[model samples]
Target: MKGQGKRSICVSLVALTFASALAACSSNSSSGTQNGTAGTAAGTTADASKEHRTLTVEVFDRGKPGQPDLNNNFWTKYINDNFGKQFNATVNFVSVPRAQEVDKLNVLMASGQAPDISFTYTQGVVYNYVQQGGLAELDSVLKQYGPTLTKYLGDDVLKYGKFNGKQFSIPGKRTVLAGSNTFIRKDWLDKLGLPVPTTPEQFYDTMVAFKEKNPGNVSGVIPYGFSLQPSNPGLNYIPEAFKPSSLTEEQFATLQPQSIWLTNWNMPGFDKAVQYMNKMYNAGLISPNFATDKDGKLLDADISNGKVGAFQTNWDGPYRTAPGTYANLAKNVPGAQLIPIDPWQNDAGKHPKNVYSPNGMYIIIPKTSKNVDLAIQYLNWMADPKVTLFLQNGQEGVDYNMVNDVPKQTGTTNSGDKMMTVANNLDYDILSNGIELGDQQKNTAAISAGYPGYEKDVENALKVGMVDSYTTYYYSLPNAADAKSNTELKNLSAQMLAKLIVAKPAEVDSLYKTLVQQYMSQGGQAVQDEYIKNYKAQNGK
Candidate 1:
């Protein structure tokens, strides 16, 4: 294979160059193993006599203003001390800003400076790379060097990596697949003598009542705080109830059921959803100037300061982890409480919510990489049970201690922060998507451990068993039309949605129609046609 030849050349070059430089750094060190071969354990040994090749992996920076040195974090050192040394490889961690991932990666690829192993959560980006033939075929590489990874991920999950019957990437396995839901102030509901909302009408009435009677004594409360920013449009689930129960065969063929921006807005009930949002805006039921909350700081502040009555968030977000929204709100408002509610009842009188896809981000090796074999070896090592346990849970004594075979965090004042500083570098874990323990019971228990007080809520969420989007199966495939016009169409759609939400009641209908027409003309139609073709070809529909 091309990767094998490259690996040989790379190893020879590195050995020749580093022979003198690393003369004192022998494989006999404490980190080294007897045979100098990578082990399944967390701390394994590597051949010190062999020169170590440098392999770079990309990680998301997450844009913390003052937190620099993402490339040299504790986790980076941990990997270097353990995995890198064990494989006779010097792993270089490259930090790509989370917000500018696509743009930065595009530039890196163009400049031939992309990391050996890169990943992205956006399927469109993966499709674009595959279409451009910029990614290496991984089937042979996995067979040659990734037996452990193959065994761990299994064929069913690995199918997500196949494009055009060739493996161009590896799909990460997600353990918990629950999506976002609406969380409301339970204390306010009790104070106002109201029941939990199950219908759209009931939800709207509840928000209005929250505005009318401020239960928490906080002035200027946002009844339904939402972020209208392009990236974090928090209102996607609110409008799901308005979606058509079923699509026409042609519409179904043309649309991707999972896409919130592309085909979702084009659905039958979308116009009504926008109209409903506009009504909420007119009534001051939603946050004013929501479009300006680009990073969700305002929403977070509102939730923390007891100024938000209700909002949608991940199932474990509000209450889970330290300094949590639920904890903060509780401190500020003496009796504040939060609980999840499925507020959108569909036409059939059943509450419908989006469920997360079982597969997660794609991990791929660029064709330009010189260390493809090293990258595969690193991922395979990461899939090992001991190594995975360390990366996900942290050092046994310092971060967590096993209780009845389940790891639990030790009670330390800064334990959460300490664990977060090291374990939050999720981009490092390239194999398992979510927290995987290789046991369903243990995996569920591990996930619940993160949320201290919301065990039942988390359990109930897993039981929801909502429907996933149609695009779940097509994530690894490329959509040429989308690659060309997705960004433009996304910006246009966001602007139009923002306008419709705040537009005068009389002007909304006309504006929405105009926006949809513009969207269809400006590449949306092309995208739909391409999706229809791909869907039929893939599903034999």
Candidate 2:
């Protein structure tokens, strides 16, 4: 719940771009991240060394671990020395926590202390700030200072950040994929002599059997672990299990009996999945406290210890701990492997399409800033691939080295400054950032180093996966009301389904009917209509 749309509560910020006329007056700033470094002498037309102005930036790594030191962060320092040396200006930096970012930004905007360049994510804050005229338009800036930027920001990338046909925000260089599929512990499946589960029913049976058997020096397993609690999007993974083949293209599609009004609870697969869950609960397969607890304690601690058999997670592996969940598990448990169970991975009846989302993370220029051009110039400098690589890894000889043109780390360095002391580093933000679809191959080495084919496996799964049905329609409702209503609807549906799982087969039908009525009353129909309208509008059909 906390990870879902809750960030919107603190997302009301001010934004607007300054007039285009000022862009011509602004000169390029030195690439130097510090106060007085010069930029590169020999560079492209947009080179910072040829221009002069101070650029301010806002990045998210204020107190976080594994970041650049304020003084030695390669990019910052490079800009300070190299860029400043060439252009005679320096870069100013601001840092904030990821969770409270929106709120902090809002406060800054209200206090009239907005930064020149700021990072704005979706969840209402960016749009709120833009609507309030607190952010700047970057069309002129991009045209004048960023011809390379113009080339990379293709049409698809430009569509999402547009509001009413005018572009207010530029998509960052990073692209984010949709939700994950069900990840099963392969070792448990092999121990139970079970094959990879292709259907929800088969998946349910495996979880049940795993709980019943209690193999591998562990007691009974927690069948089907999840982090879905109050108002969390993690529960979104559930509906996929019971999705009707006909509505596979549209999980939130209308079921064609508005007169009868069959809700999601009554859908063909809906009741069955819930009934299975209830059975698991009553039989002690599922933890009884699952409904009340959502911190993922049951999944993270219990499953990580090899006590739980199966859980829903992203393709990358245990989302709670990066690389640790998958890496450590494989290292500790013999034959431990992550298996992705697709709700529709093998369903030939449906054309698979993963969910597509607009860019949540963006770099923007606040309207209140004194030096808009300087900020844009700094961002432009950061966008360079060479700069990106430098930020991510470190200096060439110190942090990392190119062996046959492939970047390899010489030694581990936690801070960018420290890394820079040794070798050149990769700037993930600069190298792999994008608002649209990105080439996984570009970041292949880094992602693999950390996740080990996790990205590719997930993408392959998504090729046959189902995207969330609500993403497109979500924007129509008032921001607050939309988030709250969806959360409540999903929670009620989960609750009802959980109950039906335990009820007698005879009692299942009636329970499902009751759920249908409740769903309709909760504006499920209106929600469906919104999706249909938006989908058509997007396709121009």
TM-score of each: 0.77, 0.74
Lowest lDDT 10-residue stretch of candidate 1: 1-10
In model 2, the runs with Cα more than 4 Å from the true position are: 1-52, 65-73, 83-88, 175-178, 208-217, 231-238, 244-276, 279-284, 319-323, 326-337, 343-360, 403-406, 419-439, 451-480, 483-509, 512-541
lDDT of 2 by residue, 154-199 (tens): 6555555565455566666434444445677777778778898776
How many steric overlaps does candidate 2 have?
Answer: 61
Report the CA-based lDDT of candidate 1 relative to the real structure. Answer: 0.68
What are the root-mean-square deviations of the candidates from the true structure over C-alphas?
8.3, 6.5
| Count of clashes, each model | 1, 61
State residue 253's C-alpha deviation in candidate 2, in Å: 8.5
Query: In candidate 1, which residue pairs get closer than 3 Å at backbone N, Cα or C atoms, i.e. clash?
Result: 33-45
